[model samples]
Target: MEIDGQPLWVAPSIYVDSKEQGIISLGHRCVLSEHVMLLTHDFSLDRYSEKMGIAPSDMEYETKGKIRIGDYAFIGIRSIIMPGVTIGDGAIVGAGSVVTKSVGDGMVVAGNPARELGTVESAWERNQAQWQLKRRRP
Candidate 1:
């Protein structure tokens, strides 16, 4: 489903990690890649129930947050995006990155914690070049 021309790439294997319904609003031209998981739940071991030594099911959990991916955002393959994060317009997430916070517009990021690598425009240009090169081969 799309909202205002934005594309939400919800794959078959992707599940919203929240027991609560996840609300997503994608801006214009946002593209979520395959196998990307949008997370909304965080489990803590601090607060626990005496009986099972586990947190109650209805305990105070921060699970209600909207994930907003801005215009022209490209989430790479197998990336896990946490809740309440707004990926800015034109930001590019490298493949397998775990996004924990908001990304700036036109920025490119990668790694387990998703650090800034470069600009999205630069990455896009490089990717296009690589795709063209591959097309010409064989």
Candidate 2:
């Protein structure tokens, strides 16, 4: 569900890591592009093999966290939103970036690790500068 007066758009192909605890959340008017992956859990087996350690499938409780995308946030295509990430309002995440840490409000972050590039002046300006609201013909 979307917050009042804020519309959320997520691509059809967006994949959630798990069907059960895929507790990825969106505040309002968030835009998630194609093939975006919301990763909610990480397995111990990924680090420790079954030969030496517990398998990921065997583990019941794993490292998991919720992802919160604040209002008006734009997540670019094919980006991976890791567990325990909070993307603040009016933030712009560049394409194909891996978000490891929380992003502050109105911040523009891009790259492999997704570092801070700059801050947006205002929500109005950020929306105007970055995205557009267009109407389709009937």
Candidate 3:
């Protein structure tokens, strides 16, 4: 587990799995909302072990890989970042998203498989417009 800078906000309920042979790196100003899960390992081999009638503790059933959240990345509430996933700088993961692949810089992703929605700049623009509209309402 390596956090690169200050002002990294992580909610209390978030879970970071760093017990495996991989690294979980959170970059500068990264925000992890409540119930966000940063997973560093996969249990795909567990089914194989079950089929072979092998004891769980007798074999290695976990595949580990690094999970990197780049600078200024925002992981929304209840989002799950899978193993070997790298979220680039300024990327945003929408609430309840399950990120299965790498997200590029400034990209906004949402949904179960976390498909790219748009860039961070677009999202910011939309937010600003909404705020301006609200302020104008009399």
Candidate 4:
């Protein structure tokens, strides 16, 4: 759907876990792959809940911060992005990766902690070459 000129696709199963508010800002054409989770809250085990006067539910806690995914970004399937993260423009998060930090623009990252796997420029160039080769074949 288009929200103020930004196209966002939130998967039906995508869960936004937050307390105060859950904000998912998808820049132009930001696609939230299947089973992707955007978390906005966190609670310490030692912390107490004001309502229950007891430990808070693991899924229910005060919001830590908001999450913003930049423009033209592709998040692979089953990626879990933690609270207070701003994923830079054109960044790609590989599938099944746990993102604890903000991703830089034009970078492809993967793995549990999400380390930089490659630069966007290199990946683009490689894709272009492959496209050209395929074009020449037919």
Lowest summed-lDDT stretch of 10 residues in model 3?
129-138
Model 1, 36-123: lDDT tens per residue? 8887665453344534656565665344467878888888889988877878998988899999989999999999999999897787
lDDT of 4 by residue, 47-99 (tens): 55635666545544455767888887888899999988877888889999889
Name the regions of candidate 4 deviating beyond 4 angstroms: 1-4, 19-22, 47-63, 127-138
- Cα lDDT of model 3 by residue, 63-113, tens digit: 877998999999999999998899999999999999999999999999998
Q: lDDT tens string, model 2, 1-138?
A: 224335478889988886653366777788889998888888654655656555655655468888888899999999998989989998989999999999999998888899998886653565776776689533
Top-scoring candidate (TM-score)? 3
Candidate 2 global TM-score: 0.76
The lDDT per prediction is 0.75, 0.81, 0.88, 0.76
Q: Point out the higher-scoring one by lDDT: 1 or 3.
A: 3
Instruction: List the pairs of residues colliding in candidate 1.
Output: none
Model 3 RMSD to the real structure? 4.7
TM-score for each candidate, following the candidate numbering: 0.72, 0.76, 0.84, 0.73
The predicted structure with the larger lDDT, 2 or 4, is 2
Query: In every candidate, how many clashes are there?
Result: 0, 0, 0, 0
Q: lDDT: which candidate is best?
A: 3
The regions of model 3 sitting more than 4 angstroms off are: 20-22, 52-57, 132-138
